[model samples]
Target: MSTEKEENQVKSKKRVSDHGEVFTNKREVNAMLDLVKQETERVDSRFLEPACGTGNFLVEILERKLIVVEARYKKSQLEYERNAITAISSIYGVDILEDNVIACRDRLLGIFTKYYINHYKKGFNEQFLKSTQFILSKNIIWGDALTMKTIYGMPITFSEWSAVNGSMLKRRDFQLDKLLENLEFDNSEINLFSDNKEPVFIPQPVAEFPLTHFLKIGEYE
Candidate 1:
């Protein structure tokens, strides 16, 4: 094997032993992502990568979603920016390694910013850029998935961002555990006394930050 290959293998083995980290090759990453190609292309579709090591999956998903945004909204700058930010906010990831979390955030943001600049010759909007970065900071979390807690030991939470009423953005936060559990239902048994047929899991936002515009997210103290 080449010296670089050998070094990579050694590092991979060490990471696997230390943190169960096994980096997926690009081919395998695409093959896996292909299974959900349609969802990846949908700008508003929500995706969560439980062990997103440097965003192998999230990066590709964002790329696909951006393509759709560009095709549909390139003529309308404001429309495109709003949808693009929604797409970025839709992706969620959690990693035990702090480095992986930071790298993934930067990678995803870089992809979006690059696309934004290519389309907008006016360079880039500062407010839009900052707001997108803020969304990423919330979506890509550093934590242990098994424990469902953030690196700070607090319950991991995620914000669901939706573009509503044309220009307004609605933000709803939910705990990772509650969102995952979803109130298990027993389909085998039916309760006659209950007015509701099955247990409903309505996600309640622990906190919310609504924005009239993407730029407004920064203005909100």
Candidate 2:
């Protein structure tokens, strides 16, 4: 039974690789993590694997996130294992293939499940799965990063576009001297490399802004 399960996993992995997905090597990951620490930035748990085959990239990300959370709480291996539920929810993954997607989600759940047992001394709860919104449809999209200009699933609204009073309206706020006048807009996603053939999407973590939750304007005030 164990051999059959292992073989099934191997076949599932192949489905993702066939689609030109390349998981990052361990060597490159270690070097990058070193750089990240040297730079000393608060990294987000939201990581994208452009070619996440069987979730190799997510596994590393999960481990790193756990380390960070442990550092935050000053926990040992025992304490870390005890608080695994909260740790597992932070790391996320995206894969193009159906089987790969399922595998990635399942593995992450397994990580959290063991944590539940460690903490509560029991198995996973059914309600926990419903609560974990880690894997979203848009999160793991099936598209060519090169050709895909904009993320189609999520819509950009006027509220997402902000300005300093009427300065943006007069094209004075952002110093749009470089951008074409025709391309100027009061509301947009605020592209960084507008003219570059390959656009870059870097996730920023803001302290006050909560994790992608809906915020009513009047509620905070």
Candidate 3:
């Protein structure tokens, strides 16, 4: 029951030729994500799409996570906001095209805003929205994933946002190249031992910021 025009898989032939851009349709996207249904539904599970184009995949993941967040914590505005932020913070994307990157961010933000406004309407907090925008600006990158650098030719640094003491968030910046460095080491080689005696490779953060209240995080640099 689908028409070719309704599919909207390719933006244009020029884009396909220039960037090899071909978006996955909704049906296919859902089918692939269903393989990891549990992770998609998890409120805090992290997902990174290196070649995300207009966020066809990332938006679906956020919607699934938000559903769980709503079902569990919708009664409490603070709780919903906290868990919602967790869901958004965990979803990341990188697109080589500037226009695609911008569209992806907007789509993800629109989905989040729709759910939020539907639930709380006029009661929604402005600070929470600002925090979400700030997190998205960092999580969604405008760069070449293959090079692990931004369009400006600088190393691509991602902020790891961890919630501490319920309301405070701790942010640590890690370079994309450094984070991928662990792949070079053999998994069988036990380079470091974790608390449970499990092998772990912990990459050092390039920068760490002071703990800031989740709602006020946007105010910080």
Candidate 4:
């Protein structure tokens, strides 16, 4: 019988043949991640892995971000926790396989909780844990990237989460297709790489919410 670790891995040959799923090994994952080392360390830098198989890239990225968070905000536990949650929110992942999506979410949450336990040893904040889990549910989604629709056949929409003015959280939703289209460079040569060129794609918000705290998102209906 395959060990649980082997079962959860994204590298099974049969899975590859069936789903085109081949996860990056640690060495390659580190090498590629090092290329964007700076961004990986920045707590608020948004990263999306359209094919985030069991979260190989997102896990590494979160580890790096948490290291930076520890160095900067360890003295203040609240600040560190908030920034850590922001780091989790900034990562987005999508995988067509429902199993992969579930595994990825659990893996990332485990990583965050492990870090939290090590730093804040005395108390268990159930609310904070729930809030983080909620963020992960929004950030890591199950969907087909090519079709740009969720497993349930709805348009894939991502909620952009931000902590504004300290402790007040804000969320704005945007359709995946529009977000991708807006990111593409314009065909017009007039403003190619112009320093003063206008922004290519400004993602118009589909829905906006102002929450007193991250945990309140679950209650917002």
Best by TM-score: 3
Q: Candidate 2 on 1-221: residue-level lDDT in tens?
A: 46988997886587556665555788887677666552222223234455565666566566566555456543343344323433443343344456666677666556545444554454334444433323232243443334332235422110111222311211111111222124434343433223222333322211122222111211222
Superior by lDDT: candidate 3 or candidate 4: 3
Tens-place lDDT digits, model 4, residues 1-221: 88888875735767888888887898999999999788888898888899998999999999999999999998888898789888898899999998989999999999999988898878667778888888888878899998999999998888877788777788888788777664555445222112244555545668887665865655555
- Model 2 TM-score? 0.46
Give a tens-digit lDDT track for model 1, residues 94-212: 99999999999999999999999998968468889888888888889999899999989999988777788776787778888876664655565332112235654545669977455
How would the candidate models be sorted by TM-score, starting from the highest?
Answer: 3, 4, 1, 2
Report every candidate's CA lDDT.
0.83, 0.41, 0.86, 0.82
Better of 3 and 4 by TM-score: 3
Going through the candidates in the order shown, the clash numbers are 0, 0, 0, 0
Expressed as tens digits, the lDDT of each residue in 1-221 for candidate 3 is 86797555445776898888889999999999999999899887888899999999999999999999999999998899999999999888888899999999999999999999999997978888899999999999999899999999998888888889888899888888877675554444332112233454557788999999999988875
Ranking by lDDT: 3, 1, 4, 2
Candidate number with the higher lDDT (2 or 3): 3
Model 4: weakest 10-residue lDDT segment is: 187-196
TM-score of each: 0.85, 0.46, 0.88, 0.86
Estimate candidate 4's alpha-carbon lDDT, on a 0 to 1 scale: 0.82
Between which residue pairs do clashes occur in model 4?
A: none
Runs with alpha carbons beyond 4 Å of true place in candidate 1: 1-11, 182-200
